[model samples]
Target: MALDRLPAYVRKLRNAAGEPVYYWELPAWARPVKDEKTGAMVPAMRNGKPMLLASEKLGSDLAEVHRKAQLLNAALTDWRKGAEGASMVPGSVEWLFQWYRKQARFTSKKAKTRADYGKLMDMLAARETKKGAPPFGKRRAADVDAAAADRLYEMLRADTGPRQASYAMQVCRLVWSWATRHYKVTGVKENPFMGMGLTSTAAKGNRATSRAEYTAYRAKAVEMGFQSMATAAALCFEGCQRVSDAFGYVDPDAPDRAAIVWEGYQPGVEITLVQSKTGNPVTLPLFEEVPGEGGGVERVPLYPELEEELARSREATRSATGPIVVEERSGNRYVERRMSNVHRRICDAAGLPKDMTFTGFRHGGITEIGDAGEDDVRPVSGHKTLAVTRIYNKANAEKARRIAGARRRHIAAIGALDEARTK
Candidate 1:
């Protein structure tokens, strides 16, 4: 009905203050359209539900009721005047979401957060299409409402982990806010994720590994008798690198070029890398750690743990499609879930009690550093804190013996000299 137009609605619901009011009788929150078949004004339904206000004649606070009505009236009046066609709604929601993301106090937000935000939007659009709703190409971003937003979140909850789903929703709030402010897509002021909901399971993310767990995992990998996984797991345990960190960046031919040769302690083909998650620059030496001129690590100034493993794996596999680590069963790269399965299998075979994860290598690297007794080894592990690195670093037996033997030799020489002088 043209009477539902903002200008018309504003004129009809004016209070004494001259502010426009929202009609509580509208079926939907703000979609006050006239019914076509019955010619009755019907509101929008939430999950097929309509507003159910009871009619009772009792002495009530008419003043307070009128005050609320005035506020609602003003909102409805403003919405009528301010909202453009349905096309303007999307822009409004996007604007509102952008504003909220900036205002949020979420800490330790990973680097891919922006990409996740985009993904959340995409997921929401897909959901609307699935539900035969707006913004599915024909629907403008402006047509979204509380019901649309709820359905968007509901779609994401089906498969994604609760915490990840919550993250997606958190970002959605920002996008909806943008829609409201700029496009007036939905006039929801309060964030859907302000507190928590049945879907708000965001606390479980990181899963840490212990030393005993690593030991058992190592045994399991060996026992499973899967040469490929064992090799991958062993390389991981020895190097303390993410599986992708090892497989994603490898150049075996770098050594053949004179510019990229490992000349003892000198740097060769040193390139700075900004860790995808941390945004920290790391000078990566593109060389393999192998027996050099004197049985020491050769070929490059930096032969990272993963790099060495990658080089060895590539050397072994002449016709592999991708990644040094290949599945013995199918020769495919180990994805997260597959890697977990491998970890569990390896632990089971090795007689280890705790099911270790593929990430065990990172923790193992910490132990190797501690064993070497080099405080500088912390940075090499690609971790920010010493507390985490300490679990991986184990004391070197040879180095300990050397230090203790020197003190023992000195004491023995002094004792012999004292005995000779007394005689």
Candidate 2:
């Protein structure tokens, strides 16, 4: 016979708990035999000897490597016992992810999905490169670890669209799960993202920013010496538009008057421009919050310089639509040059903190609305929901009642003490 004995196959010397046991001899059909140092072993025939191959699969210490070994072995024990079940193998995590990414590329309905994955892959590569001294391009998907995935999430936290980050993770995660359930023909369950939640990589990020910081940021923007920053800041405060929405230079379509009306109903104050993002038209009637008289309302008017800017926009775009602000005398379009110039000026001049971005304006507005009142502040802020309106209402009903009760008891005790003294 060409072969004296069929090649000696591998049998894991570990149990479901990953406790190692001695093995004097194993069947030739077995494929996975583990040694203590290597954890899982692959066998190769050399010079009439069966040797085990080992390598650093994690590239770092996996705190639960033993646990994973246990799980892998337990799941594949039937195959090792010659029972009709799936098998287990090493380095199957990569296979699962690769298969998932391929399926995602095929079945994704959104046109932007492929592009999104492309960006994610690039980001993952760049992040891994930064960790080690390796060349940037050398970091591949197979090499990504939990540490790298954690960083990828942090970068995507600031996206403006709600739940985009959550949805993106779901796409990749679903694929990983599918691989584990379907692809393990050899009884080797491969789920790389298992226990991912235990790591910081799977944590949800904070999105809310308070109002006080946003107000200060306005001053900082002016200090930044941006050409139109001062005006944009004024727009943010008076107009209550997000920085991106606040393009200090008004839309060319706005009417010449500072009272460029919009459909947004911000309680009593009229907004001069439409918010491009939500397209929620509002009209905040002009009036100081006149506490007793239900806050008087009047036509939306602008301060002199703001009025002048609006006028200039009209003069430039007389050929176009109304409510136009700061436009080139020659062009039909409203170039953002003046607006961008002013924004930078304000930020540099104010020396604002690095963390404050243009979006913080909206956060500030939310806080301001909260400060106005609670019982029925709906008219002033136009908050459609109590949660939306009550952000400012920090009043605790239980605490207030307790304070009142304590005051009454103190008064009664004082009166009794005074009678005793008189007697």
Highest-scoring model, TM-score = 1
Cα lDDT over the full model 1: 0.44
How accurate locally, in lDDT, is each candidate?
Answer: 0.44, 0.38
Model 1 spans with C-alpha error above 4 angstroms = 1-165, 184-191, 194-212, 222-226, 249-323, 329-341, 344-355, 367-374, 382-423
Q: Model 1, 277-374: lDDT tens per residue?
A: 34333343434345778677765323343344344444555543334455555544443345566666666666654634566555655554554445
Q: Indicate the worst ten consecutive residues by lDDT in candidate 2.
A: 52-61
Model 1 RMSD in angstroms: 20.1
Residue 422, model 1, lDDT: 100
Model 2, runs deviating above 4 Å: 1-117, 126-189, 198-236, 242-279, 287-345, 374-423
